[model samples]
Target: MEELDVNVSSSEAFGIAEKIVLLSFISAVILMAILGNLLVMVAVCRDRQLRKIKTNYFIVSLAFADLLVSVLVMPFGAMELVQDNWIYGEMFCLVRTSLDVLLTTASILHLCCISLDRYYAICCQPLVYRNKMTPLRIALMLGGCWIIPTFISFLPIMQGWNSIGIIDLIQQRQFNKASNSTYCIFMVNKPYAITCSVVAFYIPFLLMVLAYHRIYVTARAHARQIRLLQRAGNPAEPRQGHQEPRQDHQEPRQGHQEPRQGHQEPRQHPPDQHSTHRMKTETKAAKTLCIIMGCFCLCWAPFFVTNIVDPFINYTVPGKLWTAFLWLGYINSGLNPFLYAFLNKAFRRAFLIILCCGDERYRRPSILGQTVPCSTTTINGSTHVLSFFFCQRRGGGPAAPGLAGQRNQRGCAKVPGGVGEGNALFPQSPG
Candidate 1:
């Protein structure tokens, strides 16, 4: 009897130690999710340069959604995990489940919106992008990201629509000796599972895939064009060197010399620098976003696939498996802040500044310091000021007759005749 007691007590102690480890890990993830997302929001809000880039607006929205997930969803989830029972009652269970779906779906939708924004910025014409991604349009997109998930999350889950055909099974499980009323049971019929998963995950995933694919293609084409231009420009360099002495004689004809100088200037420097910079920016942005998208997929795809599959299989999926996948998805909220800080220089800089208590030494020069020149052009009867580093002009004056206006008020420049479409990929500095 004493031996039995000692063995049982040892097992219990081991179990308690295991539980402590698990709870500690969960708490760390929750804390990281909260602090990391808060930093993302605060960095954007406090940094003037980050605010100027419209793409960061989408990022801010994503962080906000993650922040809510950390605050409203994660703590309760951790509690349920540690307790191994739903102590919060049925109504709160519904609320918690609804919030989890809502915030996560909102986060996925925000990513889709961001991919769309980048697609328009990189793949479409500047005029089209400017028209399509206007402030009002952006605001509408953000609103849709938050609002669209309610149909799948709150409305369905709270109304018992998810458990429609499974009501009997749910009731049976609740009354069974092995289960109890304290368990927060959430089950879905096949139809509800499919509908909810499609709305919340699959559709947005498809859109993001398409958008990123097109962006990849466009960026590759731009890169190829840049390479060809570089090769062609290389041969002209030696020719210019040989012609330097001959320019002494041509100086007498100032008119001819001035035109040649203007033409040669762009061929020598502007196109190469501009195209290279634009290509680098596009590549960097694409890489960063793709990493984010990939992480999101890695984190959520299994849970969603299981979410759709478990219903068809009669919910034979183990409860432990369900918990594992759900918390895996939750970990994504924490992962995003680290992803941003590690992959994006701007975010990293801001993070360092924030962490260091806003030390001036952590500050870097703003992209605004690299301003080129701005020219105004009228497209479809509306005058728009375009900013560019160096205007590639065919002649002495502006590329278009309407480009006679002064520099843009925002201190940004544009290519005179839509020649700097690449520059339009980022209205401000690239994030």
Candidate 2:
């Protein structure tokens, strides 16, 4: 008997320790999601350079959705886990579950919006993008992101649309005295589950994939064009008079090259350096956005896939496994902050300033001629500067009527080729 009693005590102690560790882990995740996303919002709002960036509006909205998930959804999910049952009333349970769906859907949709914004900026008409994506239009888009999810999630959940007609097994289980009435579970309505999954995950995912693919292809084509231009331009011969610009955008075939037969040479065409610079920007942005999208897929896909499958299987998925998937979705909110810090230079600079209270790099020069040494590296052959409005304007390009209005803007300059103009084929940096 004493031996049995000792084993029982040890088991209880182990269970308690395990619970503590679980609680601590969840708490850490929630804390990270809150702090990291909050920092993003603060940095964008506070920094002069970041504030001027129009695309960051979508980023701020995304961070807000993630922050809401951390505050409204994760803590309640943690509560249910720790207590081993939902202690809150059914009304609050419905509210909490609705928030879970709404915030995460908002996060995914905001990503879609960001992808679209980039697509227009990098691939569409610059004037159209600037005109259409103004502050009011962006506000409306953000409003729709939240409103659509609210209608799909909270209202339907309250109206019992997520619940199927009475199930004999679930009904019987509910009446049993030993069954936990406080535990919350979806009622496995096939139509509702499928519809929600399609709207929330599948459609937006396809759009993002298409946008990024086009962005990638466009960047590649620009790089190839620049290389051909560089190889074809010859400086050895001088022309007698200025040559007319070629109208054909197509390049000469490698095997079909011909030498100048006359005693004159091709006119010395100035370097379209801004075209190369814009291509690099487009490529970098595409890469960074792709990484973010990849992370989103890895984090949320499992949970959503399982959620859809559970209904088809009559919700036979084990409670532990279901909860695990839910937590996996929540993990995304925490991961985004770290991803931003790593991939985005501006975010890293902002985070360092926020966390360390100040950055020496941003500090002013001391008196008496003392100055802080700042080292810079040229990445990918360009002198890298942090431009919030990247690859949207250029200097040295042929001045166009379309770019005349933009010329007054800071960092707008004429570059070789029609760089600052509204040409879809070439974009220019704001540097």
Off by over 4 Å in 1: 1-14, 174-181, 236-286, 340-342, 364-413, 416-431
Q: Candidate 2 versus the native: TM-score?
A: 0.70
- Each prediction's RMSD over C-alphas, in Å, is 7.8, 11.1
Candidate 2 residue 373 Cα shift, in angstroms, is 24
Report every candidate's CA lDDT: 0.69, 0.62
**Which parts of model 2 have CA positions greater than 4 angstroms off?**
1-21, 166-181, 233-286, 340-342, 363-431
Q: In candidate 1, which residue pairs get closer than 3 Å at backbone N, Cα or C atoms, i.e. clash?
A: 386-413, 386-414, 387-413, 387-414, 388-413, 388-414
* Per-prediction TM-score to the true structure, in the order listed: 0.75, 0.70
Q: Supply the global lDDT for candidate 1.
A: 0.69
**C-alpha lDDT of residue 62 in model 2:** 84
For residues 1-431, could you state the per-residue lDDT of candidate 2 as single tens digits? 33422321221233667779879999999998999899989887776555665656777888999999999999987876676555677678778878888999998888788777766665554456668788899899889888889877988888877775734443443222333334554554788888888888888999988987776676665566555444433323333133324313334632243343221221223333443555565456556656777888888798879878976765566655666677888888888766643345555666677777887875433446642111111211112222212223344554442232233233342222211111221121122
Expressed as tens digits, the lDDT of each residue in 1-431 for candidate 1 is 33422321221232567779878998899899989889989988898777876677888898999999999998887776566556776788899889998999998888788778767766666667779988899999999999999998999898888887778777554332333324556788889889888988899899988987876676566566556545544445667789878877776786666886665554446445645765675566557657767898999999999999987776777666777789899899889777644455667778899999989887877657754433434332122223332332323444321221222223333432222232332333342
- Highest TM-score scorer: 1
